[model samples]
Target: MKNLLNSVVGHQAVIDRLTSLVTTNRLPNTLILSGAKSIGKYKTALGLGQNIFCKSKVGASACGVCGSCLRVKNEQHESLQILKSNDGLIKVDQAREVTHFLSKQNNVGEYKVVIIDGAEYMNSQSANALLKTLEEPPENCFIILVSSSLYKLLPTIRSRAQIFRFGSLTTGQLKQIKPVDDWLIELSGANLEIMEKLQDSSNQEIYMKLASSVSQLSESNYDACVKQITSFTKNKQHSLVLIQALQSLIHASYKKSLGMSMQKIDWQEPALERLSALTQSQIMELFTESVKFEYYQKSNFDILLIFESLFLKLISYFNGEAHHASMDRYSYTP
Candidate 1:
């Protein structure tokens, strides 16, 4: 029905399946949609809600001119209930609200609809409450659960629902993105356009300062790791992303030290030489620990202190010939 349903961008496969589900009258009362943030998973659920609420049922198709359609579009439908996540948690009371709403007779529509956003936030009690409802779903009821983290849900609760996986966006599909400074990738929780977004701002000053200090960390030359990471994460706070980028540089340094790769970023030579004195595993351990430390910094344990301590570690790792600085004393957990 041209009625209450709204269109969503990307994921044609998901759209096609949903359309089929509605058209065939085989719609599942419990729908678990998992995907990234800012993506259209919740939007899709809303679309499904509209279709279910549409009054006209011609071979399972919704007619937009029906009273139900109008009510759904205006969000005045008595049988429709929407539950949102609060403080990253969707409580049991909200789920119970759905049950209560659905139990009532439809004043203007044939069925009841519930849209649960961030269903992953449902705590143990909340999920158990939902399990009660899902186990004995009332006739003519539709429940759509949207979540970013599916594994975080209870296995019994998850098993009761039909799972619909929403995949990531394609590069070409990125055109639909609103022109934000940095695009948060819904599935991965990383910023894809962070560096591009940062290229136009005064934020370069942070990188410049970071770059200057990068050299202070090493003896052979701090350029390799320092230049790559600063140049990369300078624009983004993506945790796994920066770690992955840093991993590439570390591998390159290892290759350079073994004289396997002829092409090296000029700044890495001193680092390669100094690191050559250490075993590959030691270097790996150091890099791995630093990656965890970076994640901790990003997750809000204290960014400045982490950065300063990390800076000191880098200096120590690079201090092949340069006299060791007393930067260790400066390290403190903030």
Candidate 2:
């Protein structure tokens, strides 16, 4: 809850740059912290805010135990305002609220920090409202837009902010954060968020079931595989995780086809061996389709239909019935 910069797992370069900027009083008023989900962008934003307001500073970082740091961590700081999505979108009203908050005078620190987590969820109207603020933010006000899909943001909004891209954590960095099983690590693709989800017993069961189903995919079991995978799609979050797991399996198979070594996880061997039969291009297509479906999960599309289409494509590929073509050309009818 504290989200101190010192507690961040990776992105040392970005942190160092931010620290230097903060020390020199040259940090931009508007910043876009763009990265994959759960990679510490929001945490870094809070940590920087804490450092800015910390009463007992420690070498360009927050003391973490100071009263100011505690307030920021607990989201009770008067000067720091965080706006998250309502339902699935950040409405114009929320953007207006941000405008109003920024217009006010700072209460506790020299700077008032506004963090828009999940900034990509801003609809057109909300984005336009927020754009006016980004164009000319109030003096001593800092706004950090944390987004996983930067491209979804309006081009005008993106142009007004200084962007810092956060990359995926390495295995070593992930382990430094917390010890994780090798199989889970491999499945998570070194994503802390996915790894945390996989750690849940129920989620793990779902993942295992998915892996098992995918491993046995064949002409004989095609209908059963579709039914089983679609059953898991009743939960949107579980569906996303399954899609991610599918991508991981395809990625491993792609690597194996190239004579690359895979994680020595015994359980994944069957899936890897089966998927390795796929040509590199075929594997790439499946991976791309999975990524597409993952994005679709955020939309209002029919989840069951989406997974069914995905499994159909996957089974076709496994049966050597899929061809190298743009997935756009492939149409699905209910």
The lDDT of each candidate is: 0.63, 0.81
| Structural RMSD, model 1 | 7.5
Q: C-alpha displacement of 86 in model 1, angstroms?
A: 2.5
- List model 2 lDDT by residue over 113-194, tens digit each: 9999999999999999988889999888999999999999999999999999998888888788779877788777777778
Q: lDDT score, residue 11, model 1?
A: 78
Q: Which RMSD values do the candidates have, in order? A: 7.5, 3.9
Best candidate, TM-score-wise? Answer: 2
Q: Which pairs in model 2 have colliding backbones?
A: none
Candidate 1, which segments miss by more than 4 Å at Cα? 1-6, 56-67, 106-109, 180-334
Per-residue CA lDDT of model 1 for 127-221, tens digit only, reads 88778789888888888888888998899988989999888776445546544322222211233344343354443434333333453455344
TM-score of each: 0.63, 0.82
Reference-based lDDT, residue 319, model 2:
74
